[model samples]
Target: MLAARASDDGALADAATGQSEGGVRWAAFRQGLVTNVLNPKSIVFLVALLPQFLTDRSTWADKSVLGAVTVLMVFVWFCAVSLAVGAFQRVFRRPGARRALNIATGLVLIALALVIVLTG
Candidate 1:
C-alpha cells in the first residue's frame, strides 16, 4: 500500500492509501504480528507438533528443511498469484466489475452454505 501510494500521482492509489502512506504499512504489520502472536492455536501447534520434530540432534536439520520448504512453497505461490492477479487487475478495474465479482462470490458462498446445511 505504501509503495502504491508513493506511485499514486494523486489518483486511485491515493484514495486507497487514506491520508498518510506510512501509517498503513506499520498498521498492517502490527495487525498481522498481533494476530499471530496472540493466537492460541498457533501456540498449541508450536508446543504440541514442533517438539516431536526436535526429538534428537538431527532436529535442527529437520526444522531447517521444513522451514526452507515452507518458504519456497510460499514464494512460489505468491509468484503465481502475483502473475495471475497482475494479468487480471485491468479486468477487475473496469466499471461494474467489482459489483459483478462480489455478487458472484456471494452466490457461490451461499450455495456452499446451503449444500453444507442440506448435507448435515
Candidate 2:
C-alpha cells in the first residue's frame, strides 16, 4: 500500500480509500490481520505444528500464550519490513526512478531466465 502510494504508476490496490495516510496503513493492517485469522491454511498449520512442542501437562493457557507471542513476533517482523519498504519507496517514487528500477528488474529477470534455461 505504501509502495503504491509512493509510486507514480498507482499499482497497489486501495486497501484503505481514505483521506489520510494513517488510514491506509491501518486498513492494510486490519486486512492482513483478519485474513490471517480467517485463513484455514494458517489454522491447520498452527494446529499441526504448535503441538510438537507440547507435553502432556501443557494446557490451553500455555497454547494461548505461545500463540500470542507468535503473533507479536510476526507483527514486529511485518512492521520492520513495511518500514524498510516504505523508506525505499520514499527514495525511489519519482517517475524516472521507477522507470530505471523497472528496467533494471526486467533485465535481471531476463538474465535469470536465460541462465536457468541455459544451465538446465
Candidate 3:
C-alpha cells in the first residue's frame, strides 16, 4: 500500500492521506478499530503491569479504579496524537509531501523487516 501510494497521483494516494472528498473512511476506521481492539500485546502488558501497583489485600474497587485510570490515560494519549496529526493534515495532503512520506514509511517498514529477519 505504501509503495502504491508513493507512485500514485490520484484518488488512492489522496485517500491514503485522509484526503477523501466524502470525509471519513468508514472501512479504514473499522479496520483500525478491530486491529486495536484485538491487539493482545496491550492486554498482556496491562495485565502484567497493573498488578505491580496492588497488594494481596487490594479490593475489587481498587482494581476497577486503577483500570479506569489506565483507560483514561490511554484515551488522552490517543487524543493528543490525533490532534497533532490533524494539525499536519494539510501538509500531508500535498502531492509531493505525501509521496515523500509514503516512500519514507515504506523504507522504514522494509528496515524493520530486515531487522526481524536478521535477528531471528
Candidate 4:
C-alpha cells in the first residue's frame, strides 16, 4: 500500500513539474489504480490478511459487509490522497521540487518497509 501511494505521489509530482494536461493526469491515475489492483501479491495479501480476521460467524452476508467496508475505506483514503496531492500541484511544479518529493516519499516507503519487516 505504501509503495502504491509512493508511486501515485511520484506520478503527481512528475505531472506538477512537467505541467501535464488533464489527459495525462487521468492516464497516470488510471495507471496507478491498475498497477495496484492487478498486482498478484495484493490478491495474496488480501487472501492472507483478511482471512485472519474472519470469524466463524462470517457468513456470505457478513463477508459481503466486510468487503463493502473495505472498499469504502480504500475509496476514502484515495480520495484524501488525491485531494492532498492536487493541492500541492503548484508547489511541486518548481524545478527540483518533484525530485525532492520523490526522494522523501522513497525514504518514507523504505522506512515503513523496514519497520514492517522488523516487526513482522
lDDT of each: 0.65, 0.76, 0.78, 0.75
Pick the winner on lDDT between candidates 1 and 3: 3
**lDDT winner between candidates 2 and 3:** 3
Query: For residue 31, what is the lDDT in candidate 1?
Result: 70
lDDT of 1: 0.65
Q: Across residues 1-120, which tens digit of lDDT does each residue of candidate 2 receive? A: 213333356344553343367776787789988997899998898889888888899999998898898789878988898889888876565666777777788788889889999999
Residue range with the least summed lDDT across 10 consecutive positions in model 2: 1-10
Q: Model 1 Cα displacement at 85 (Å)?
A: 0.8
Per-residue lDDT tens digits for candidate 4, residues 1-120, read: 223343343344444667557777787789879987898997888888788778997899888887788878887998899899779878876545766766788898899889999999
Q: How much is 36 displaced in model 2, in angstroms?
A: 2.1
Summing lDDT over every window of 10 consecutive residues in candidate 1, give the lowest-scoring window. 1-10
Q: Kindly list the per-residue Cα lDDT of model 3 for residues 1-120, writing each as its tens digit.
A: 465744465444444676664445555456666887789998899889999999999999999999999989987887798789779978876888877787798999999999999999
Alpha carbon deviation, residue 9, candidate 1 (Å): 18
**What are the runs in model 1 whose C-alpha is more than 4 Å off?**
1-12, 16-58
Q: Write the per-residue lDDT of candidate 1 for residues 52-109, one digit (tens) a residue.
A: 6565676667888876775576568756976897699777765456556666887888
TM-score on alpha carbons, each prediction: 0.56, 0.61, 0.70, 0.62
lDDT of 2 at 120: 100
Best by TM-score: 3
